[model samples]
Target: MKIALFATCIVDAMYPEVAQATVTILRRLGHEIVFPSGQTCCGQMHINSGKFAQAEPVIAAHARAFSDTDWDVAVAPAASCVASLGHQQPMVARRMGNDALAAEAADIAGQTYELSQLLTDVLGITDAAADLGSYFPHRVTYHPSCHGMRLLRLGDRQSDLLRSVEGIDYVDLPLADACCGFGGTFSVKNPEVSSAMLADKIRTVHSTGAEVCTGGDASCLLHMGGGLSRFQRTGSFEGTPDVTAVHVRQTSSTDVGDDNVDHLTAVVGADDDDHLTPGEKGTSPAEPSRIQSGFRVGQSAVHLARILASTKEDPLRVQSEGATVSGGSLR
Candidate 1:
C-alpha cells in the first residue's frame, strides 16, 4: 500500500516523532510512505475560529497538495485534522462560494484517513505488538481530542492499537471525556475558564497515576503538556504541573464516548442569566479561584475517547480487544 503522510502543523513543528512513528508503523506493515511538503495545516484553526475568508487559500493548498498525489491513501496522525479534511474543507470552500474548490475539497477529504483508520480499516492491522512494533513500556493513558471524538467519529481504532502494543501498561484516564481547557484561541480569550477546565482534566490525569499521558492530537498534548510543564516548572503553577496546552480545532463525533458537557459555572452565559467575568464580579481577588476549583464537569471524555478510539470505525459492527501486559510490569 502506498501512503502519503499529512504532517499536520503541530506534529510537523513540535511532535514530529508521532508522524515518524506513524510512518515507521506503516512501513513495517509493508506500506510505502510519501510526504507532501506543501502540507501545512488542515485549516482547522481558521475554520474553527470562524475566519472562512482567511482559510480559502489554506483549503486550496491542501486540496492541491493531496489531489495531485497518487497514493492509495493519505494518512494523518491527528483525527481532528483528518476529520477536518472531510467535514470542514467543503464547508470552508462553500463558505467562500467556490463550487469548484468545494468539489476539489470534497475529493481531497475523501482520500484522507486518520492514523488508526488507515491501520485498521485499510491495513487490516489489529495487533500493534505483532504488526507495528509498538513497544511502550510505561504506564500511559490516551486522551481523544474533541474533533477526533466528535467530528471524525474515528471510534477506538487508536486505543485498540495502543492496547495491542508490546509491553505497554495502559491505565484508564479518569474523566476522559472532559475537555482539557485548550480550545485553541479559546484559551487566551477565556483564560480563567480554560484554566479551570484544564485543572479538572489534569486531576484526572494524576488520579490515573500514570507516568505519562498520550493522545492523537499534538495540539491537545501540547496544551496539556504546556500546563503540566508549567506546573512542573513552578512546582504547582497555581495548582499542578502535569497538564498542558490543548488542541484548538474540532473533529467528528463517532460515539467515542459521552459528549454531553453542560457549560461550567465559570463559562459566561453557561446559565440563562449571563454572568460577569470572574474579575468583574465584586468577589475578592481570592474568590475567583474557589469558584473555578469548585466546578466539576466533562469527566467522561478520556475514557470515552480511549474506548471509542479502540474500535468501531464502521459504526455497524465494531469490536476490539484491549491490550494488557502479560507478566510485564512497569518500572
Candidate 2:
C-alpha cells in the first residue's frame, strides 16, 4: 500500500514525532509512505473561525497536494484534520462559489483516512498486541475527540486498538464521546466555556486515575493537556506525576510503548514554571483549576500498527482498569 502521509499543520508544527510514528508504523507493515509537501492546514481553522474566504487557498493546497500524488490512501494522525478534509473543505468551497473546488475537495476527502480508520477499516487490523506487539503496562483511559466521534464516526476503532495492546489496562471513560472544547479557534474565541468544558474533562480524567489519557486528535490533547498543566501549576490538581494524555496520533507504532510512555513521563512531571507558557500550552492563570492531586498531566502519541508489527513479546499485565467517573464525583 502506498500511503500519502498528510501531517496536519498542528502535527507538522508541534508534534512532528506523531507523523514520524505514522510513517514508522506503515513502513513496518511493509507499506510505502509518501510525503506530499504541498499539504498544509486542512483549512479547518479558517472554516471553524468563519474565515471562509481565507480558507479557500488552504483547501486548494491540500487538494492539489493529494491530486499530485498517486497513492492508494492519504492518512492523517489527527481526526479533526481528516474530518475537515471531508466535512468542512467541501462546504467552504461551495460557500465560496467554487463548485469545481468543492467537488475536488470531496474527492480528496473520500480517499483520506484517520490512522485508526486506515488500520482497522482498510488493513483489517484489530488486535494491537496480536498483530502489532503493542505493549504498554499502564492504566489508560480514552477520550474520543468530538470530530472523530461525531463527524468522522470512528466509533471504537481507536479505543479497541488500545484495548488490544499488550499489558494495557483499558478503562472506559465517562462521556468518552464528549467534546474536549478544542474546536480549533473555538477555544480561543470562547475561553470561559472552553475552560468550563476542560475543567469537566480533567475532573473526569482524574476520577479514572489512569496514568495516561489517550485520544485520536492532537488538538484536543493539547487543549486537555493545557488544562491539566494549569491545574498542576496553581496546585489545583493534587495528584502524582503519573497521569498524562497520549494522542494516539499514530499511536505506539514507532516503538510501541517505550517512546510515548517516556514522553508521557516528561509531560506529567514537568514543573518548571517556564514550561507553563500561557498561549502555547493553551492555559491561563485566570482559569481556576479543579483537578486534584496525585493526578499530574502529560501528552504523547502511540501508533497502533507498530504495537503489533514488532516481533517482541507482549509486556502488558492488565492491571486494575480505572473507569472514568463524571458528574457528582467531580470536584
The number of the candidate with the highest lDDT is 2
Model 2, stretches more than 4 Å misplaced? 237-331
lDDT by residue for model 2 (223-299), tens: 77676656545645333222243322234756756643222111332233334447666332222222422353442
List candidate 1 stretches off by more than 4 Å: 237-331
lDDT of 1 at 271: 35
**TM-scores for every candidate against the unseen true structure:** 0.72, 0.74
Mind giving the per-residue lDDT tens digits that candidate 1 earns over 137-192?
55667787888788887678777777886666798765677887888778878888
TM-score attained by model 2: 0.74
